[model samples]
Target chain A: MTLTWDMQDAKSTDDRDVVLEVKDLRVHYATPLGDVIACNGISFKVYEGETVGLVGESGCGKTTTAMGVLRLVQPPGRIVEGEVLLDGVDVLSLNEEELRRVRWNQISLIPQGAMNSLNPVMRVKDQIGDAIQTHESRAREAVKERILELLNLVGLPARVYNMYPHELSGGMKQRVCIAMAIALNPSLVIADEFTSALDVIVQRVVAQTMLDVKDRLGMSMILIGHDMGLQAQLVDRIAVMYAGNIVEIAPVEDIFEESLHPYTQLLIESIPSIKERKPLKVTEGLTHDLRNPPPGCIFQFRCPYVMEHCREVEPPLRELKPLHEVACHLFEEQDGKIVDISDESVV
Target chain B: MRGLTPGYLIRRLGMFVLTVWLGATLIFIIPRLAPSDPVAAMVSRLLAQSGSVEGSAEMIEAWRARFGLDAPPLIQYLRYMRNMLTFNLGYSLTSFPSEVEDMVVRALPWTLGVLSIATVVSFVLGNTVGALLAWRRTPGLVRTLLPLSFTFTAIPFFMLGILLIYIFAFGLDWFPVSGAYGRALTHNWNWEFVKSVIHHGTLPALSIVVTSMGFWGLGMRGMMITTDGEDYMILAQAKGLHPRRIFWLYGVRNALLPQFTALALNLGLIAGGSVLVEYIFAYPGMGYLLYQGIVNTDYTLIQGIVFIMIMGTALGVLMIDLLYPFIDPRITYETR
Candidate 1:
């Protein structure tokens, strides 16, 4: 089924609408022992020109959800039981022929480790030209011209066209990847942990460069990162995932200030802020295994305010306030009315 | 930084000369150090041909002087080095009528023709099929062929050669039993001669091809499997490149770096033809000549053949070093 986002909730001041909506996207990997559920019913939406960040610690299935959105997950890790609606076309259902047409033209990916993401043996121009060459038979001059334009767009020199990947620095190679990603002017770009491998300074530069490119091109994006601070600086909305489930999602401002999910609150507190220098709060338990997850709320084991019923029943993601959603039994109180945890009376 | 500089070229050329010189010295000295003197046999033969005591001493002196055996060992070695430096290897002791150069030139084509073609064909075909097998996406009989390829590689070349000879030569009678061409056809530039040459060369060529193709295929497959793990491979796929383009352009191109060196060294391996197999097939190649040179202790012939081997391998190494930069961008020729 096509994943649908209600128009009222999709309302934004910028007047853009949803370009990508992932609903109940469950990606599982089959191993010798058993099946590991990487992404269990994950869902999110990216509106036009919006940067939706999927923030989580490593192995929390953030990349898997992004791979699902692009239909690029390989064998043994299948995107099972999901709808990845890119511009209303279920990318999950597209055959090889149809997917070829959509991939890199309508949607592209700036893969993780862009430093080595390019073909090392090929020149930067040829590597970038591969995207154009695959979708359409463009002229050599046109390809060269497009590569130069893309290099210009990514702040790379035209001389990089003939250089191999080994000749470029880590940051330069990443820029080349950005150029290739937007070569076709795809409507959506997925940046999967793109800045995780860069230094703090280069990270900011590349992240801003990506934002500048996004602003100039007016494309939607799904940026996956573990750093909430990094996500806050760039994305409009943040979907904080835990153990293959989106525990909380709201505007970047609200995710930090008015986070209804305890996990999100803990995550925000756990960041060692330079302004405060407070001792970082560490979560007490290992993440639940996807192979055999608990029967009830996945976070109940580590959750501080776990109710008796939370151990037995799963809590669906419910909207506790305008544009703020949290999956927690704590929100299921006071006769279905939303409870403000910050208010002293609730404690 | 990676440009081919004059200094680097000069250094490599110097290295090539040093290697050839060392090889020539060892071959020249090792045979002299042997217990039995090859020159003594020729001297005794010369003495037997003379009538008797009358002018026998003069005849012995003439034979020794002709072969440079009358001089001190060190002087003889120096003279031999100078002769080899000028491309003169004297006459074969066993086949005294022919010069060492003449015999080697006559035997060159048989070894080069069959082995060179077999090696190149196997390299191309094996590497292509190997890249396909390790691509991991497409499936159909690749896994089945995997074990078989490894098994084929594990089998020794001579054993495989013997097996092919047994099956195709003896059992089916499909190809010639031995030799480079029909004895009836004289070596010429005509189609008939070429056709007969190929016809007789098929079995030996097949022996080399079957034994060697497996090694190249196995090597490339391993390299491809390693390359498949490289992030560029995923990047190529994400670029929406066709499976075929990615297989060749990204996968095989990178996978070829190691295999290319193997191919260059295979040039050396080409000249060192299968002595046992060539002997069994009675092919008139360097290997057969090498066998005869060793058995008869034809010092001049042995030294000549060994010199060719040393030159062939040294050239192969030099070619590999020169082409490495082109194959892999990481290899740069830096100035000292």
Candidate 2:
């Protein structure tokens, strides 16, 4: 059975069926003090065969959201409230057995730190074969054959199957991880900082391999990264998240060119490009703590174009133009004010 | 086979020589430094009982000459080293009628047999239990059982030996109380004698097992927990491996590597049996032989037993060093 769904509104001409839909997701971690709302009522959707880039600073709940979807969160950190509908079924509602069936077969995760993810004592082939044997019923010989096929798919020679993890280089290990993630041909794959550990040159190759795999497998991806330039080259749509809330969602070109949200604009301006010889503008103030989020908007302290209304009341996400959404009071007409402030005041 | 580096081997050999020299000095000097001369004491007692000085000086001189006690301390030490090099372990002072070699030869096999069985059983049981508890998010019953198993290891071997004797020998009467065999067969080497010997050896063997089993279990458990946290285990899970496969193939296999080294060390040190435990159980093992030598001041027998223990431990360490590269390809004798 094909496990895929659509999440695009009827207004857009590029409406593809949604592969995954996350609605009103509220995942809180019970700390010593109280509930630290990691993902506070956040919502988004990914369409079939589309790459959605989740860009945010550290501790902004991007990684937590991904882990929550996979049900990989350990104790004290939990998905307190949410609907993670994969295809049509709510993943959060599934029991352990049901979760096991869908985990690698329907949706796979390329976890963070690829280099350390493999067993040093085991042969790489046996490690890969383990996954195949877990979700499928096959003979030992057949599993061995499938492992070889997977190695070939990930651009690794079959010889790597007999070698241990320590024998392989960093790049080779990451490739093996990629191969392992796609061993089951899952419809949706989440690549969580997969290329973050490699050198710049290796990162490029690994990133390109991820894109190539997605193209070949015809799979949708939720690429979570802090590197905006890398995401621009790979992801089809970018969702700019700050303090556990996506402040902007737009096509890659729109995000780079006409970013409606001030935070998104600042983020894009910060990226060092050859043509843009201007000094890279960095947003002032560190990322806010998610435990006790500010009164209204989470980004009020860091937002350069923050208004009094932005601090007192939260701005709901509103469409500024076709296929572009922003959650800022300045963009909307509120109480007869255009709300555009002078550039000096923001500086 | 890289073996040990030339420099490392030289260092180890130098250390071995130094240890032997120090051990010999301490053994000989402590006896001499005592307030009373043992030979003089023996002669004085003999005179007191007989009430005669007839052949007293000649008898003392003969005793001194026979054992090389008449020589200077340095000369005696040199003679001891020469005899050690020639593999002539000299005669026992207590077992003057019988040779020290005969005593050690007769005791060695019994000690090895019981200790070997106990060590192997403890390792298997401890490691299996530890691995299972570590790999599984165990229930409260298993958690309770684990701490209780560790309790057996916490008690001293000799104390446990006495406890087992009181319970099994006196209270419940399941096993024989003491000795290698029943008094019925003195010269018989048949199955009946062998069975009785094994039955009597059980309590002492169990004492060693209880005292050492917790170490293996705790080691395996710690290693398994660390291995579980490793990237490879997560990778295995990510690869869609079944929980069982993850537990055995990834968890247990990697965890067993360090535990194997501990087991090998235990095997090497087994030659030095628990002296107190052997005494309590009255088992005719090396420990009992060593204890008898110490009590009777049989320097030759004590030196012989200590030498065997040192060699056994050294050989065990050497075996582990050689086997390391075979078990873990990442480890290299030259590099690390």
lDDT of each: 0.83, 0.79
Model 2 lDDT, full chain set: 0.79
lDDT of 1 by residue, B1-336 (tens): 355677899999999999999999998878767788666665566567774445656766777888888899889988988998888978988888899898888887789988889888889878877777787865777666655654666777778878888898889998888888888988788999888888888877776776777788878989999988888887777777888888888999989998988888889866766687688789989889989998977888988988988889999999999888877887789744
Weakest lDDT window of 10 consecutive positions for candidate 2 chain B: B233-242
Tens digit per residue, CA lDDT, model 2, B263-325: 777887788776887788888889999999888766678888887777667667766766786
lDDT of 1 at A152: 93
Can you tell me which runs of candidate 1 are displaced by over 4 Å?
A: A1-15, A332-337, A340-347, B41-62, B142-150
Which candidate gets the maximum lDDT versus the true structure? 1
TM-score of chain A of 2: 0.91
**What value does the lDDT take at residue A238 in candidate 2?**
90
In terms of TM-score, the best-performing candidate is 1
List runs of model 2 lying over 4 Å from the truth: A1-8, A13-15, A139-141, A275-277, A318-323, A333-347, B1-56, B68-88, B128-136, B185-194, B334-336
Task: For each candidate, give its TM-score against the true structure.
Answer: 0.93, 0.87
TM-score of chain A of each: 0.93, 0.91
Query: Candidate 2 - CAPRI tier?
Result: medium
Residue pairs in collision within model 2: A5-A18, A6-A17, A6-A18, A7-A18, A117-B231, A118-B232, A119-B232, A131-B239, A131-B240
